[model samples]
Target: MRISPSDEFLADLERLLLDQGVAPDQARAAAVAVGVEWGGQSVYIRLRGPYLARAVAAAYDGANVGELATRFRISRAQVYKLLNKANEADRPQLEQARLPGT
Candidate 1:
């Protein structure tokens, strides 16, 4: 599936990359590359780590699926898929966290 990232989202991503120490020019270039691929059609950009965590947290906080899809520029199905994957990955840590203090 493809995501048509919003201009705001792309700008945020560029800023994030910059914050992570990516060169300003490189960060902008990367954002632009992701934003415009396949002759100006939508492209796929995998959301991982903190991005996935935030999305899942929003869902758990009762954000509407359609709204999340629009905000994240992904389809509703992709949001569900990401949530499932995040839940699965977090299960072990969550269970461990519930254990007695270290």
Candidate 2:
């Protein structure tokens, strides 16, 4: 199936928020807010630190590192770092899923 750039971006953002422990409803709301805010801006608004890392990581799943780097305007190394951070965040969940009861 095909997805528009805007839809892909929003989906990536939502996933990033959700991975960071935001509730599904809140993630969608936050993604919408981000779109609205950025849509009205004439200049670029840079996202940094952990938030950017998470966003890049989430986007990586749907896109390659090169695409993510271009989309987020970062280097490949940075993308790897972000993806690594995201993986770290998922470690606990991964461990839980491996448990017998789970």
Candidate 3:
């Protein structure tokens, strides 16, 4: 299956919000809200998925790992694993977030 442009746009908006210094949870929630409004739950879930949750956690400024594990319904080990992968997957975003003005 292929991603539609709207799906891509929503994902981009999430990243943009994060890059612009919006809280990770807020950015993700905004994207999910827009996705649901424009498409539906299935579309939003399909596009965002567990990986996006992991990414949001990674970008999150001070998230507690245990709490994140509980919230995302994953084991702490899995959360650490996914966070590592997410950091690698979106290294540029991490870098951008670290920039002085961001």
Candidate 4:
């Protein structure tokens, strides 16, 4: 399956580190190590929140909300909130796509 860009980057970094003489396990660990915590949330979330929200919303439409909440370790309410935010964010783009006279 196609992986996310972050995952791909980590893999590449690990390989590069190994080539540079880092031990195998250490290279892998270093590749996955990211110091992203900020203000009670991860920098990953801060940067990718909207994208994640939209992905969550799409999954909510096709999958079990409870399972999604459990997997994300977030409350059901938060799941809904993300979905709503995603929908709101999508509205303007959707509106702009409509025929001008229609």
Candidate 5:
């Protein structure tokens, strides 16, 4: 079965990386690590006020997905993925509104 990333999951992972001073690409891998599911692994993220959430949300508001990707330093594929996950079902929550350190 193919794996899909949950918006909440990715947001939390991003916050964790931000807290640890990790790079986005590094955080990408870590995000994927948790985003993947196949049993055995058991971890999840519940972000609040995450950077990507607000950033992506703002970008997704009035710009094309491609443009948003460039602005965020990610690929089109990643942008599309974020867009889909970020729709109503993936809107940032109050609990998921914080970064790692702040």
Candidate 6:
């Protein structure tokens, strides 16, 4: 199947894949190959999958991936995966906690 992408989409994918050590040409190729187009022809394609968790863990003051991974007692890969899931599940709780009456 073919896919349609926004200009920003391709750029973002290219950047993320390359940052993950995917070779330039290979990153472009892989990002191109891994994509799905929706009814409106918008595509959501990613090479590194969910990275927000890794980013969040790293964002806490003075905390890096190694530190967060150590705290979690898991390989860096599992930390990324679990953090991704945790961010999603925590959103509702986060919103509730943020409410004025909370």
Per-candidate Cα lDDT values, in order, are 0.75, 0.83, 0.76, 0.74, 0.67, 0.64
lDDT of 2 at 47: 72
lDDT of 1 by residue, 27-48 (tens): 9999888767644565565665
Write the residue-wise lDDT of candidate 5 on 1-102 in tens digits: 654445665778788897779998889878777657523455453432356655676667555877777777778787766666667545567348877777
* lDDT tens digits, residue span 1-29, model 2: 89767767879999998988999999999
Q: Candidate 3 residues 7-35, lDDT tens each?
A: 89889999999988999999999999997
Per-residue accuracy of model 4 over 1-102 as CA lDDT, tens digit each = 988666666788788889879999999778766412222233333633676687688778555789878867778888888888988988999999999899
Using TM-score as the measure, the top candidate is: 4
Model 6 lDDT tens row, 9-35: 666888989987989999887656654
| Worst-scoring 10-residue span by lDDT in model 2 | 39-48
List where candidate 3 sits over 4 angstroms from the true fold: 1-63, 92-102
Ranking of all predicted structures according to TM-score, beginning with the best and ending with the worst: 4, 2, 1, 3, 6, 5
Per-residue lDDT of 17 in model 2: 88
Candidate 3, overall lDDT? 0.76
Estimated TM-score per prediction? 0.43, 0.48, 0.37, 0.51, 0.33, 0.35
When sorted by lDDT, best at the front, the candidate numbers are 2, 3, 1, 4, 5, 6
Global CA lDDT of candidate 6, please? 0.64
Q: Give the winner by lDDT.
A: 2
**Lowest-scoring 10 consecutive residues by lDDT in candidate 1?**
37-46
